[model samples]
Target: MAGFVNVRRDVDDKFYRYRMPILLTKIEGKGNGIKTVVPNMADVARALSRPPTYPTKFFGSELGAQTSVDEKNDRYIVNGAHDATRLRELLDAFIDKFVLCGSCKNPETDLILTKNEMIVRDCKACGERTNVDMRHRLSTYIIKNPPPKKGKKSKGGHAEAPSPPNKINGENGDPDGEENGAGSDDELTRRIKAEAAELNADTALAKEDWSADTSPEAVERRARALQSGIASLAVSNNGGDDDSDEDADSPYSQLGRWLQENPGSSAIDVFKKVQELGIEKKHKAVQVLAQGVFTEDVVAEIPKYVAIFAKMVTSEKHQKALLGGIERLAGLDYPDLVPSIPKILMQFYQADVLEEEVVKTWGTHVSKKYVDKETSKRVRKASEPFLKVTEHFRCTGNRAN
Candidate 1:
C-alpha cells in the first residue's frame, strides 16, 4: 500500500522514486449530464507542485469537454466518462509540457511570468530559464489562475516571513498590536460593516456601508487590478508582442537568429554584421555566435561557415570556446556529424585556424555546457572517429620531428 506511483511511464522498472498518488476516478450522474470526478486531484497536483486547476483544465482540453473544480471542496470533474488509465495518460502529457523543464527534463521548476507577460520556466535543477511554448491551450488558464508563488527558503527551510497581514486589519491606527482611540475604533467598525455588506448584499446596507467606498480612487484601483489580470490572461493566450525584441535587446542573440535564418550567408557578411552590432571581437563571443548561428543542418552546412570558424579559432583563447560550442551544436544522436567533425578539424588545420595541439586535445573529455553530463559523454563516444584521426596526425608529426 505505497499509495504512490512514479510520474513517469516506468512500469517495467519498479525502482523510480518520483512518486505521486495514483489517479482516482469517481464517475457521477448519467446520460448527457454524466461526468468523471477525481477525488485525489488536489493531492496529485500537490505532488507535482502545480495547481489542481492546471491538470483539471488539461483533462478538459484533452477530452474535448468542459471541466470544473470546486476548490473549497477539492472536487475536480470533467464532462465525460474517463477511466483512470486515460486520465493518467493525459496527466503525463501535462507533466511533460508544464512540469518538466525542456533543457534538463526535471520537474523542479517555477513557471514565471515576465514583465511582458511571457511564461518561462526557471529550472531549479539547472540554472536555466527558457521560454514556455505559448501555443498550448492550457497556457492561458495557467496564467489567469497561476499557482501561488513559492517563498524563498530560510536556513530552517520554512517559507519566507508569512505574507502581509490583511489590508483592513493593517489599516488600524495602532497596527503594531496597540489600540488607538476613536480613529481606530471607527475604522474597525467600518471594516466589519463592509465585510457583512459583501456577504449579504442589500441595497440599503450597501449605501450605508461607508467602507465600501464609491470614490474615484477606489474605482481606479479596482479597474487597474482588473486590467492587470486581463493583461496576464492576454499574455497567456497570445505570444510576445515583438519576437525580434529579444534579438534587438541582445546583439549575441541577434547574430544567432540571423545566422540560423541565413545559412548561405558568407563569413564576410557575418563578420560585418558582428561589427555593425557593436559586438565584442572576443573569441568567446564568436563561440557564442557559432552556437547561436548554426543549430540545424550544421554537418552539411559546416563547410559553408569555414571562414567564420576560422576567425573564431584564430587565437588560443578561442580554442576551448569554439570546441565546446561545436560539442553543443552536434552533441548527441547526430551520427552523420561525427565523421565530418574530423574532416572539419582537418580543414581548419590546413587553413592554420587550429593548431595541431588544439586538435590533439580535442579528443579530451567532452564539454558539458551544451548537453547534460550523460549526453556530453555519449557525444564524446560518438567522436571516436575524429579522435583516431587526430591521434594519427600526432604520431606522424612526432616521427617527422
Candidate 2:
C-alpha cells in the first residue's frame, strides 16, 4: 500500500512504537488529506486509523506539523485564505503607528470595515474620514523603505566631495557648469544699462510736469466756473464799479478783491455773507469757506460756522454732513478744534436712535479718536448701556468690541 507502516520493537525490555505513512486520504472538499479529515488532533487521529493508510501529515504539512515561524511566512506569501485572517491585525498596528486625522492631526481613530467593499477610518478628534486601504499601502511602503543617510565629512579639515552632476542632453561642458545660464555677462550688463536709462527719462518728465506754472487766465476760468449760477446777481453799489464787477462776476476774485479793496472788513462780515446763502447753495459756500479756512485767510470766521452746525442742525442728513465737515476740520490738526470732539460725540449719541450697528460704528470712531487711556475707558463704559439696550431689543449681531 502507498501508505504508512508501524514497527514495534523491544530495547532493554522497554517496547517502542514507530508509525509511518506513504499516502494519505484526501478529504471530500478540503484539498489536502490531513486538513480535509479533521481540524482537531484527536479527530484527525481517529480519521487516520479508519482510513486505508495512516496519514502522517498534519494540517496538510508533509512534515506532519508546521512550526509557528514557517506558518507565519507561508501566511505572508500565500495572500489568499490564511493571509486574510492576519490582515486586520496588521492593519491595526499600521494605523496605530502612522495614520493621523486630516483636520486635527489626532491619531485616535476607529477602523470600520465597511460593507461598501472598502476599509475606512474615522477620526475621533475632528470627525474626518479617510480611506484605510490607501493609507495601508502608503504605510507599508514607508515601513519597508528608509531614507538615505547623509555623508560624514572627511578628516583633516576637508569636507566630503559632492557627487558629480549627471550629464543630460549631450552637453559639452561639465553637467553643473553654467547649466542655469541664459546669456553672457556682457549681454546682461547691456540690458541693465538700457533699463536704467529708460527709468531716468521717465522720472525727469514727471518732475517737469509737476513744476509747470498755473497762469492767471487759468485761475480766472476756474473762478468763473465756480460762480456760474451767481453771475446774474446785481452788483453792490457800495464799491467802485470796476472792482465791484470783478467781485460780482467771480467768487474767488471777490474774496481776493475784498481782501485788497476793503482791508478793514472784519471776518464776521465774510462769515455773515456765507450764512445768508440759501440751504441748497450752502454746500458750495461751505466748501469755498473751508478752502479759505485752510489757507488761514478767513480762519477767524470758521468758529461761527462750527457753532452754527453744532446748534442749528436738526436734520440727520445735515448732521451727518456737519460731522463730515468736523472730521475734515480735525484732519487739519487744529489744536483749537480738539476740545470740540467730546461735544460732537455727545451730540451724535443724543441724536442716534440707539440702533445697535449705529452705536457700534460711532463707538469705534470714538475709540479711534480718544487716545487718552482714561477717556477711552470712560467712552467705552458709556457705550455699554446703549449696547445693552440694543440687545434687549434683539439686536445681537452688532459687535462693539
Candidate 3:
C-alpha cells in the first residue's frame, strides 16, 4: 500500500502535520480511449481541503487533456497515458498557487468566491487572504462551480427543516408504517438523543477548567512576562543587569501595554506612538513591540508592519529580539499555533523584518530566555524544516567556493 506523503513534498517529509495520500494512477482503455484513472483523487483532495473536481479539472487544464468527474462514484479521469509522477508534479504546482497561503505557505486555506467573480484563498492557519491567479483556466471552472458553503444554517431554522414522514399509510392504513424504514430510524434517533442528554447532564466535565489560565494571578503573571521578558533578554544579551527592576511604566512595558490595548492600530500610528515614547532608537523595543502587536494572526499581520519593522529592526541583534518575541508569542500565548512557527518565521523573513542569517542562527539552538525550555525546544523543532533548507544552501555554497 502506498502510504501518505507530506502535502508539500518539497518540505521535509518527516513533518507529518499536513499530509496526503500518494497519487495513485492506473492506465485503462488502451488506444485513443486510453485514460489515467486517479482512484484516490477524492482522498487526496480531502487532505488538501479542495474539491476533487478542482484538481481533476486542473489536470485537464495543464495536460491539455479531457477530464471526467464521477463524483458519485469517486472516480476522476484524465485522458491519455500520463504517469503518476507527472500528475503529482502538476498537483504540487496547483497546491502552491491555489491551496497554500501566499504569505504563510500553510495549506490550511479555503477558496472563497467573491461577488466580483474572483476567487481568494482564505488561510485558516495565519488568516492571510490573497487572490488566486485568474490567469489559469481552472480558475474559470472554479468560479463557475465554486466549493459549497460550509456550516451555513438554513434561514428556515432547525424546526422548519424537513424530515422524513413519521409514517406512510399502506392499503391497511397502518399507523406504524415501515415506509423507508422510518419506524426503526425514529427508534434509533430516540436512543441517540437519550444518550446525548445523559452526556450533557454530566456536569463534572463541563465544570472543569478546560481553557487557559485566565485567573487574576495568571493574568498578572502573563502581563509581567510581556512587560519584563523581552527587556530582560535584551539586557542579558547586552551583558547588562538582567535582575534590574523595571517599573510598570518603563518605555518597553508601556509600548507592550499600548500594543495589547490597541491591537488594531495602524503601522503608521504605532510608529508615531513609538516616536512619542522616544523608544524608536532602542532596538530592544522591537522585541516588546512584536510580542504585543501580533496575536494568532501574526503571519498575516507581518506584511502590514513591514515599514515599521524596517525602521526598528535595523541590525542582527534587533532581528534576534524579534525572533525571541515571536517565540514568546507562539510558545507561551498561542501554543496551538506552534506548528506554524516555520511559516511565521518565513513570513517575517520575506517581509525583511528578520535577516536570513539571523533566523538560521536562532533556529540552531533553543534558548529559555524567551520562553520555557520545553516550549523553546518545541518551537525550534517545528522550525527544523526551514532551518535545514537554509543550512543546506549555506553548506552547498561553501563547497562551491
Best by TM-score: 3
Q: Residue 280: error of model 3 in Å? A: 0.9
TM-score of every model? 0.38, 0.20, 0.41
**Which digits, one per residue and each the tens of the lDDT, describe model 3 over residues 141-223?**
56434564555432211111222232111212222121221122232233223333443435754454434454677656555
Which of the two candidates, 1 or 3, achieves a greater lDDT against the reference?
3
Taking the tens digit of each residue's C-alpha lDDT, what string does model 1 give over 315-341?
A: 455665566556555553233455466
Model 2: clashing residue pairs?
Answer: 3-22, 4-20, 4-21, 4-22
Candidate numbers, best TM-score first, in rank order: 3, 1, 2
Q: Which stretches of candidate 2 lie over 4 Å from their true place?
A: 1-271, 275-307, 310-314, 335-340, 347-401
RMSD of each: 28.8, 36.7, 22.7
In terms of lDDT, which candidate is strongest?
3
- In angstroms, the error of model 1 at 299 is 46
Reference-based TM-score, model 3: 0.41
Candidate 1: Cα lDDT at 68: 75
lDDT of each: 0.55, 0.31, 0.65
Question: Over 4 Å off in model 1, which ranges?
Answer: 11-15, 152-401
